[model samples]
Target: MGEPEAARAEAALTTYEDDKLKFKVQYPSDWTTSTGETPASEEILGGGARDLFTISPPGANARDVNVTIVATPAGADFTKMGSLGDAYGFGYGLVVPLNKPRAKKGQEDRIQFAELIDSVGKGDYYKVEYKFAKPSTGINSIFFVLAGLGYDGRVSHLYTATAQYPRAEEDKWRAQVEAIIDSVVYPPTIYG
Candidate 1:
């Protein structure tokens, strides 16, 4: 009665490539794409992202139903961070300052859950999942993040892909979000 499952899935996605960021990914065909310079507040490792690319579902704001990718030039400090697990810890610790100021008095934002999903390429790339609860809005957001290292001849770079959506819709969107994350092809990297 309908298209085959494989065909239907393929037809629902569109591919995006960033030459400067040197990465490729597939997002839902109905979603929109935006590119810009990443803000200092979004920097996780302190190296600061050189560029940012975001894919968002229709009618969704920047903070809702979006996947963002940032490329940061890997410095000596980043190299010394060791495994992907260690990097996640170091980066998440920085979230306090970023969140504290925006926290409301009665409804403080907090991490509901966090876990290290897996790593590939002998720790060169990793996958993690976390949930952020916003009691102010009475909504919980689930985040799926992919992190990896890439080199472009002269310098090394850290590229992170983060996908988030309302936890209430997890049953409806988790697979699609995971598909988008898994579709990423990192820039000139041995791992990914």
Candidate 2:
């Protein structure tokens, strides 16, 4: 099916798919994915949390979108997500404030996630999330991101989605990252 227009008005709902084996999600139509590099408003850090990512199309009112993969040592504890910041050097505990932020009325879970993300970014930073789900391929991952807009009205994001697979399994996550990059629909490149 064609990309379903983004819903939530300001938050358009789009269509995409994923390789459940890699636990990776793709983007809507006209979108494309790239590897080993940042996409649009996205940036891939060189140290700390290794990651791969892509961002939303540079369009009117559209926010940046990315798919990153980071890693946590096996048996790491998620309960103290806040403390894990300085503990891990990935900015988790550094960004998230000890006191949680208030979410809009009637939005507890969403608000909670938002607060967590905000804290993890450590300021001007965007997001930090976690996902230890093991995929069908048996590859585990540590995932998170930081996102917001720069003064240019363009989305800005940093994310990591690292995989814990056999060294030989590198191709799997690489393929997943490509798929997400392929899904972006950014504005046409303009070279003045």
Candidate 3:
């Protein structure tokens, strides 16, 4: 997506801001948000403690699609983190592996598609996507990970948006989730 696409449409959106995190994003109005804690037992990514905001559609369950935006003091070696395989290891080592095998009905999950791109604007950012199967429920799960390397004195921040839904219902949530991902904004003061 380009800068134009980065701008939010005039559709109804709910704003989430944190002066301390020095960033904000607008998600669909229908989605509900839950605040996150720092130094959590379970983390969004490795490095420093992460403050997570999980936005979910109404009536969502464990299998529903949701977006998790996080701010952490973690930093990544951008040079080593710009490929599908690299993203996989980064997630596996620092976060959750996409293809973790689950003994569900004797079926093992696998990655269906994966891509990585390094977008250089004010700084370096790696954008990644992994679509895989969830053997437990026989559904497909999609993960979009955006890592913004350090800018000036600020620590690295990551945005991870994910969806797990039946194939029949993907059309209903994909675009909405993408928009939420693109709407993320970092304060200009942090830039070099």
| Residue-by-residue lDDT tens digits, candidate 3, 59-111 | 76634577776765434443222422444455544334333544455444342
lDDT of all the models against the reference? 0.70, 0.33, 0.55
lDDT of 2 by residue, 1-192 (tens): 655554433143244322211223444444444444323334464333223443333331122233533222212232222323432354454334423345566654333221232224333323444433223234233334433211111211222332122224345443433444333322211110
Segments in model 1 whose C-alpha atoms lie over 4 Å from true places: 1-3, 39-49, 76-123, 137-139, 189-192
Worst 10 residues of 3 by lDDT: 113-122
Native-structure RMSD, model 1:
4.8
Span of 10 residues, lowest total lDDT, candidate 2: 148-157
Q: What ordering of candidates by TM-score runs from best to worst?
A: 1, 3, 2
Whose TM-score is greatest here? Answer: 1
List TM-score per model, in order: 0.72, 0.26, 0.61
lDDT order, best first, reads 1, 3, 2
How well does model 2 score by local distance difference test? 0.33
Q: What is the C-alpha RMSD of each candidate to the true structure, in Å?
A: 4.8, 17.7, 7.0
